[model samples]
Target: MFSVWKISLLFMASLALTAATIPGKKDRRPLGGWTDVNVTENDSGLQKALEVAIREHNKASNDQFINVVTNVIRARRQIVAGMKYSLNVQIAKTDCRKSDSTPENCTESELSRLSQHKRCRFVVYLVPWLKKEELKQNNCD
Candidate 1:
């Protein structure tokens, strides 16, 4: 006794529900674990590279910030897998200086006004750290 419209609506709703309930396939590698390494506050190239890497990684969201360091070097190959875009990154010669308080403790305005001089510099790579082999290959000591 259902009307054509009602049947169609029910079918569509069922389809939507089924799709929602089904979990997506898991990715072997996820980009959520990565971070950005900027030599300066306004370094567009580094930002673009990070953006490209994130896009290539197919991560769920791009609102998060990642700090690329030596620790991330182990996953370097995975990170750069589909990155077609380019950006200049350098090995951080020195450690990044810490602020008196954690990022959460800082005000939004203060965080927004952050500068690159406070971060490390080495300009060939944008990640925080590099593996020995990767470093050697990139000529980044």
Candidate 2:
């Protein structure tokens, strides 16, 4: 048992050292699939994408309660024909039910059946010239 504990500690230390020595690995290219973008929660583009994503999700989801973004974890941008944003966000359930309400006026729901929190990854595509925003994907856990 002592030997196993010592070995585990040594292994963990080695893994930490290895990680610390490794350089951030990625070649930032123009067409790279998803590159981290410098964006804040206040960024209009990112905010728009989040709204569109949530709205689209609500439309497609079977859940009666609506969900809204609580925070943005990560946001990445990809260039193809248009700009595609891949965002990892924290979302929580709201008091509003999809059947008769909208998220704009809904508050967070903390009640038993309404309490739900999830990390969602949403891909939103934007075409500025055409003034369009579309959701490419919405996945949550």
Candidate 3:
């Protein structure tokens, strides 16, 4: 009787240990995707806008990330095409950072803000393009 009880207890302990070592299914996906924009320099204003939009989105019941894409489409009687824009967004629970060092690398205060507010961390991307002449024109501005 004593040997049987000891064997049962050992089996239960091993099973518990194995279960504790395995990761939960929900904890697996990557945090964010690459941005579509070719950013040569850091733009503070754009970053701020993204942060604000993300904060609002995550505060809602559904947690999702937003993706904005743009395309040029021809308009009637126009030599150039009009820009077409679309936003694709969805929410899923995800791990923001797997390691402790992420907070150190974040420039935007949004990460810290999310931590304090107990909100989901949202990922966003903005894409924009300009013709050569348009780029030259904007270069002077």
Candidate 4:
């Protein structure tokens, strides 16, 4: 007993509601326990991603910290859905500076590139969802 126009209107309203409910591409912070940094062609992007991951992990786990080992940064950009990053980061659980060293003021990026720190080598792979399995099998440790 409903007209075609009425049915179409109802369908459109339902579609609109569904679209509104779908989540946007939010900058989802890295999962709590492990920190993951995405490597991009641009150094700035890599640094930003690493910083975000570290911050996320620290926020989630107050008693633990992820320390970036500056000397060991190896990253490759992946060509997927345009361009994505695959960052190979070496991290430790302690801060980069030691308790005895001269307290030096350094930026996050600078700290990532520093050479002196206790190393607890653990590799984490980050890729676009599409290439996740391939990257994971090859990179994750």
The number of the candidate with the highest TM-score is 2
| Residue pairs whose backbone atoms clash in candidate 2 | none
Provide C-alpha RMSD values for all models, in order: 15.6, 15.1, 21.7, 12.6
Q: Write the per-residue lDDT of candidate 1 for residues 1-141, one digit (tens) a residue.
A: 999999999999999999887767663235534444434465554544443343332222232332232122212222443322223332221222232333223232342323231222221233434321111122122
lDDT of 2: 0.80
TM-scores for every candidate against the unseen true structure: 0.19, 0.68, 0.23, 0.32
RMSD of 2: 15.1
Off-target runs (Cα >4 Å) in candidate 3 are: 1-40, 63-93, 96-141
Q: What lDDT tens digits, residue by residue, belong to model 3 across residues 11-129?
A: 99999999998789866433342233323346443343334333444343243422111111111111223222111222222334323323223333333322322222233332234
Residue-by-residue lDDT tens digits, candidate 4, 2-120: 99999999999999999888767674333342233434344664554444444443344444334443443655444444334445555444443433222123234535433344432
Candidate 2 least-lDDT 10 residues? 107-116
Candidate 1 vs candidate 4, lDDT winner: 4
Q: Which portions of model 1 show Cα errors greater than 4 Å?
A: 27-141
Q: Where does candidate 4 stray beyond 4 Å?
A: 1-42, 60-62, 81-83, 95-141
Clashes of each: 17, 0, 3, 3
Which residue window of length 10 is worst by lDDT in model 3?
132-141
Clashing pairs in 3: 63-91, 64-90, 64-91
In candidate 4, the residue pairs with backbone N, CA or C atoms under 3 Å apart (3 or more residues apart, or in different chains) clash, namely: 39-87, 70-112, 70-113
